[model samples]
Target: MTTPKTNRKSGFPAVHLLEEIAQLLAEGPRTSNELVAITGYTKVTCCTRLKQLEASGQAYRVVAQASVTWYAGRKPAADTAAIIPRQPTVRDYPVIGRRDMLVQAFFGAPRECRA
Candidate 1:
């Protein structure tokens, strides 16, 4: 009589896959499709891993009107403030009446009709 040989590499396959998914989420939030493309895993596999992560409290899901976004940690507050305030940029300024003024300033005033 001979005992059957086991071909197991690791005990927890789900944990291993979950760790890979968590690493990806740590980089930033992502959609399931993005995970699929990045990990080269099927959509169902990615989604299953995400659900497992969510259950384990290592990740979370945000449902929007069109799609769901997954983040790598506990769900953030709805009104969380940024750790560092952002510096204002050109785009931050209002454009209501600055376009024409800026153009005229750069190019000089349009030539006036000499009567």
Candidate 2:
């Protein structure tokens, strides 16, 4: 009878990869591409591990424009606060009257407005 295959060598490689990724993240925040390059893992694998880290609260992601950066540890309250989109102010939108005046000035009044 053969003994069950139980040994450190038989352990899941993914777990080791997770530890490596966690160690890297502990040093500082990094993007998925950076992780892929450092760990020699495919982008899909790196992103999968990152998602697992996030789900476990061992890491978090910060998305800015076109890139996403991953950081170690549970996400900070300050980070979430910063991520909350601010309410739009009146200045954010140009008044309809002002826009119409500017358009008319630039392109002349519509034919309907001609005498």
**Where is model 1 more than 4 Å wrong at Cα?**
1-15, 77-115
Give the per-residue lDDT of model 2 (tens digit) for 9-48: 3243554778888999999999999987777767897798
User: Taking the tens digit of each residue's C-alpha lDDT, what string does model 1 give over 1-115?
Assistant: 9654322433334436668789989999999988877766568977998998888778989999999999988766622544556776656656454347888889977765589
Each candidate's TM vs. the true structure?
0.52, 0.56
Off by over 4 Å in 2: 1-13, 78-115
Model 2, 40: alpha-carbon shift in Å?
A: 0.6
> Please, what is the whole-model Cα lDDT of each candidate in the order they appear?
0.75, 0.81
lDDT of 2 at 113: 43
Task: Single out the weakest 10-residue window by summed lDDT for candidate 2.
Answer: 3-12
Question: In candidate 2, which residue pairs get closer than 3 Å at backbone N, Cα or C atoms, i.e. clash?
Answer: none
lDDT of 1: 0.75
Give the per-residue Cα lDDT of candidate 1 at 66: 93
Query: What's the lDDT for candidate 2?
Result: 0.81
